[model samples]
Target: MAGGTDAGAGAAAEVPGLVGVPLLGSLFDLKSDSLGTYLRAQHRHGDLVRVTAGPPGMRAELYCVFSPEGAQQVLASEAANFRKDNAFYQEVRDSFGNGLLTSQDEDYLRQRRLVQPLFTRRRVDGYAGAVAAETASVIAAWDKAPDGVVDVSDEMTHLALRAVARILFGTDVEATAEAVARCFPVITDYVLRRGYSPANIPRHWPTPGNRRAAAAMDELYGVCDKIIAERRGAGAHTAGRGTAAQDGPVQDDPAQDSAVPGGAGEDLLTLLAAARSSDDGEFDASELRDQVLIFLLAGHETTATSLCFALHLLARHPEEQDRAREEISRVLGDRTPEAADMDRLPYLTRVLKEAMRLYPAAPVIGRKAVADTRIGEHTVPAGADVILAPWVTHRHPAHWPDPDRFDPERFTPEAEAARPRYAWFPFGGGPRACIGQHFSMLESVVALAMILRAYEFEAVDTEIPVGAGITLRTDGPVRCRARRVDG
Candidate 1:
């Protein structure tokens, strides 16, 4: 089916929305409860629904698509008609600049080509041992702690940060880890908060929140710059991994061998430093820093957030946890999980898919209509905002039966293949989907295997407190009782 709907001459009709109170529109509603308000609008309206936000002068209409067909239309079919220059990307670029996530057109293509090799399947798999090591390093701290409540959210956050820090920047970034951990949340939260708000204040204005965000950004970028400076300045020095090492294993890319500079290093900063264009040009300081910042911030935070939810879901559903643990026990036993073992652990993979389906780390994918476009039969005006919510779409009863239940079997090969492509896009779809998705999933699977194998998690609360931001995050923290496992 073409986008799962047949569009006709009615393309000029206006998309539906509430004629809200005078100037406010849905500003208060979205600001107060974005996730709730968004889902409700989709249910009450239809798959392709319209929601308004902001005051009269700055009134904005957003098209929220919950149908896979609609998602395919914007993300795949007519993707070129949409651009990433939406409010969300604009604000986020404050931290990411023109990195892959924010860059478009030729810039995006070039940078994507340069950075794509780092996340190739073979490379990511090679990094698995490192993922396990980093995760082991953080969770090991908890092994000796007294039995009590730990914010597993905080735990995963630290684990994911340290894992990405070393994996991407190598051991040298270990010193910058604490500072980056402290600062990035501020910067990212600020960017996300602004992205969701209907009314946006100017960054040039000295707002307290903006000032705090700016300061956090400085600290965040300072760390990135330090890593870049150190990597480039050292000539051939890397923490421990030599220049000859590939970031992972060389998969299929011929560019990998030559893309890297003189076999000096393969950590992200080193690779970027070594990366040369067809023109034999190296990135300037700003260009290099931008890519690092995106990887460092987006790389860790999104996975950490997903990991936090996955652990929480398993904690609440002991049966699912037990099933997954059984699989881990069978495949991994008392041994640690390596990337090579991933394909052997099918059930563990399903558990992750189900968890992400319920609580997608990136709940909404935002785009702007660059030209008038037809989403289904409706004409979306140029400059209008388009939002695809994996949060809502993943729960749509049309595609998913028992939408709220914790069921991993839905992700089994037979079941997943039965659904449409965009029906369960946790990392998004089409060309602009998350570049680090493979890397993120591998990190999560490795961490999950290790955590399940070593510990038993008891939920302190049945209700999950969720907040929407640069990524979906638990409002305060996801607390659980942790007890180390014994053979």
Candidate 2:
């Protein structure tokens, strides 16, 4: 009854759609090549496409908005009409806990109010030293790589994990990074498998998959909980500072100073542990764990994907790589990059932006229409699923003339200004836009600059096929060989 309702008497025709085969609908197609499916749907139909899946008796209808304008409407203008009341979000919330990423309404607002201060430009920039240190470690290891070829995907993933971990856990980075690196993939995979299924056994059941996922969840939670408890009990200011003080007295050098303010060796974990709202409400232990878990999961995986693809693309295109390298050389001839250098290297920043465009970390975003809404000519009735697909919209031919081609110039000032606001959002737009977007860009630009300055890359595995997991995942290794750059 709800599905049949219209926006009004003059509502436009039904949304163009892909009518899948009987029974299973587009399940197999989605499970196989979701990105391709979204792309084809846009090419065949129009922006607003209706997709139906599942059996006749249990059919699920999805209203897909793939145009920049439509995306703006769904994610920004009329964002309240579309809610994260979908199944996938529920799965993420269940496993990851309702941190800023999945929380809604007042809870999200409160979390945002408290967490926003931690991500200010000044504070995030302070983490540049941490990012550079991690990149240096990766470069040092690559210096000894057999034949100079390294798995770019795996290496970036580890590098990003360590970088974020250092900023999050400080001296405890080694232990936390190890546990997270081991446990996050298992949990994310479990979330994906169960999230998409029409039916699932209770997670507490003793099935192999259940047991494995539960074990991973326990291990991941154990590490975070342990650190959080120690921080709370010992006091956030002094808890994680043990190793820093033991290693040596505080250095006067800016490069060697702790990433946090006051040079007290404070990490983001301690900041979160001690953050207080206007009313002096702090995150409880469970709330602290939830925030840390989401930060670990979102912080590392998205940035790693960006760095991997950026390096791979530059490898595939030598001229672009040289240009970027030249900029880095000109800016910082023989010194480590800092927060101030983020804006100094614009071309390198463009390369990173282009890479994100081609392989957005979160390709397909899910939402549900809570009321009858008109998108263009079609009316999406109440209680229908809605999908805002950056994967498809990024390649929309109307704006991006040659969408698939790798061109950093597309992000140049004039070019970017000419396009619609939502046309190039790797981070979703609106009140709910990614809180870590600035942080992601800073980490990416800083790391990419340092790595390119250190080595020249030539892609060995160029044709990387990616799939939509919880985030974009490469189907196989993305390999590249690096030769050290001479001054």
Candidate 3:
């Protein structure tokens, strides 16, 4: 492929120089509505477009290619040249340390090898029961209210947090749910705002929202630390000692309880404790702490946002909602769905897929090129930021017919097989793809099935505006009425 060559076949006309002003070039337009701006850029410029930002004229490139050939090249063929951008990684590192989400290259490879097994299909399936039980408990609590309006975002956040707490921490932690909820806006706000502003402020400084976020993070970590302490205290004495250490007296530190025998605990913390690296190295306390924070934020918030949007979509499109309900009813009959039933609920899965396509939780995945690379006919300079947007790709007319329309059939095996591999990347693609993809899919299937089996959703406010930050969400509360369904 010739760099800078106009491959006129599927290319839009290239604009000379970068789009937007220096220091803030296209930043406002990009941030205002990411998907819309991306589409416009692709239509106006070409598959590859240049954007400038920062005071010293830092330039980045955006690609909105829906072609199978282009998608494959970026996501797979030239993956080595592309890596997560420093700005995004720095934000996560500030919050999560150098855990899996923020770690690069060799560190990422090592962490992934150790953590990948935990998300295997079998292990992910094990979490279905916990997802179902948590969904049921949440619905049961909601049943106490009589035909009232509920904020779907708030409700979903609470449900996801509770589910993660029960399954990942082995502690209900219901009392702290309110406190945890308060932390998200602050965290999200700081992250999004900092992306545009160049100033770097320490978390310890008494800034308004930053201080609250720091406190909330402390509260969140405090809960995890307490759980770790409890487990360590219980498991310390019985923890296995190697044959060479038989002569030594055992220390009474509760922290050693993480080394307990038999892998007895159900919490993710315990699993992390018991998990050994492929090379047999164990995660130390700090590593374990960083992972806990990463999982807590990544596991719940995105799933919660997706579920909220799914419900909102169902509310607006009654026919699709009916199909989902019918599928749930027929698949499970009268019993609650188990892991085995997930494979049988194809329509439910399709509905969730379409929901994610229409309203992706994480709108875009970004990368920075480490070396000069040619994508199609364009030679992207080293240090240029590259973005793969699910929000834009899922709505691209070239891949999806009536791209803006909400249709579940697009996810049917035949329909899905017809599109490019990266055409509908809600959770991303390739080696660095989301490790929790299966887990999130299973969680959504089980939760949506359980909800549909009991109630029919109706839209109370059809005009609710969509918003974005870490996840695509409703601007205001998603008010909806849930009517009981006859069994």
Candidate 4:
């Protein structure tokens, strides 16, 4: 929140940058194609390029960090010096509530501590059953597809939403899933538009956009709140006798004993309802809604993106697809896949990893420099808005040769060990990394293994244009023809 000291200010060399039109700079270019802008900036201006836009008083200077080394410095090594104090993040926090993804400083620390246990490897693996069930449902539904053609994008999105909803709400999943499907697009689109805009009309104003976003939020919040209330009521019936609240937190085994009345026992909602810390008590109803909302937003969309792209890539490359399918068949024959199958099916994991390498969910990560920090040879002054782009860093020529190629071999254990830790950070790195990392991977590997096992895909749409939103998004349907593997 403070600026760089006067002592360091004069000596700090200016970062090499892209100078666009006078006053406006590169704002329009960035707005039009941020991913392209990031790539061009890295290729033409090197990793640490300054990209400024807007007129004098409203100008925004983006200190872009594109190299693996620089990404590490900003996101991991010198992470404390780079805080999530940017406008985009603030907008997210306001829209979604200060849950783990948007919370900072002590609040982030507290949220992480409270939410960590729920996402542990042991706990996340438990959700694989849910993922398998959801994936099976999707695979079965493909039987109705006309001529066995399906949109990988739409299908994966639906599958992921169902999977996460089932895990999060359990028996109440049906109640929450449709609402999330209907409202999330409205909310995320609103966040993106307002987040990038230089200025925005006050949300309270009766503008059409504001009214629409408000209605969507109300519907979304209303549904989630009703479920939370019902879950609490059910918990009270089971544990509190006639009282509305539980006696206290489930201290002995919060993860296991947190089940409520309807057999939604180990679902994330129950866990959050029962989550407690020595210093901090359990989440209140409002807090619970916030955490659930954030999880739904982050959980489904990211894995769906990874699954869509992975299937599309495999559809486009049959030989690679065959190799991955062979591995799946060898490892899991005539049976549903589970989380434990992840290590046994290493090649499939590599396929998913390679897909993430190409199409990372969160492409452009933002931060504000908390102090004068040296990145590579450039000094990013305190208070400067910084961008850590995984989309660019994952494809950095120094780290990834033939970066544009879709080769799962790139993620082989040996190849991965040889590369910089930050070179292929699709889940990001450091303390503030995604809390649901294991859940995401577990869901993806299990779902992908099953889907690949069910169908042999041939890409109908060989190419998909993408744009950056809250996550990487496709501009058009990623279509593929699915023939039954048995046939």
Most accurate candidate by lDDT? 2
Clashes of each: 3, 0, 1, 1
lDDT of 2 by residue, 249-313 (tens): 22234332334642344788887776664453778888988999999989999999999999999
- Judging by TM-score, tell me the better candidate of 1 and 2: 2
Candidate 4 collision pairs: 259-265
- Model 3, 1-487: lDDT tens digits are 3333223424533433446775667767766766677667666665666655445544434544434455555567767777776576677777666778778788787667666655656656767777877898888876766675667788888889877766666554564455556765676677777754556677677888778778767776676676667766776323342211111222333333323222246555666665663353666667767777777777888888778878888988988899888888777888878778878999888888888988888886677777766566566556766766667677777788888788888988999888778787777677777788887888888898888788778888877666556667567788788877875
Q: Tell me each candidate's TM-score.
A: 0.91, 0.93, 0.86, 0.93
Q: TM-score of model 1 relative to the true fold?
A: 0.91
Cα displacement (angstroms), candidate 4, residue 309, comes to 0.2
What is the number of residue pairs that collide in model 1? 3
Kindly report which residue pairs in candidate 3 clash with one another.
Answer: 168-268
Model 4, range 251-336, lDDT digits (tens) per residue?
A: 33443433332233557787677777557667889998989999999999999999999999999999999999999999998888
Note the residue pairs that clash in candidate 2: none
The 0-to-1 C-alpha lDDT of every candidate, in the order given, reads: 0.78, 0.85, 0.69, 0.84
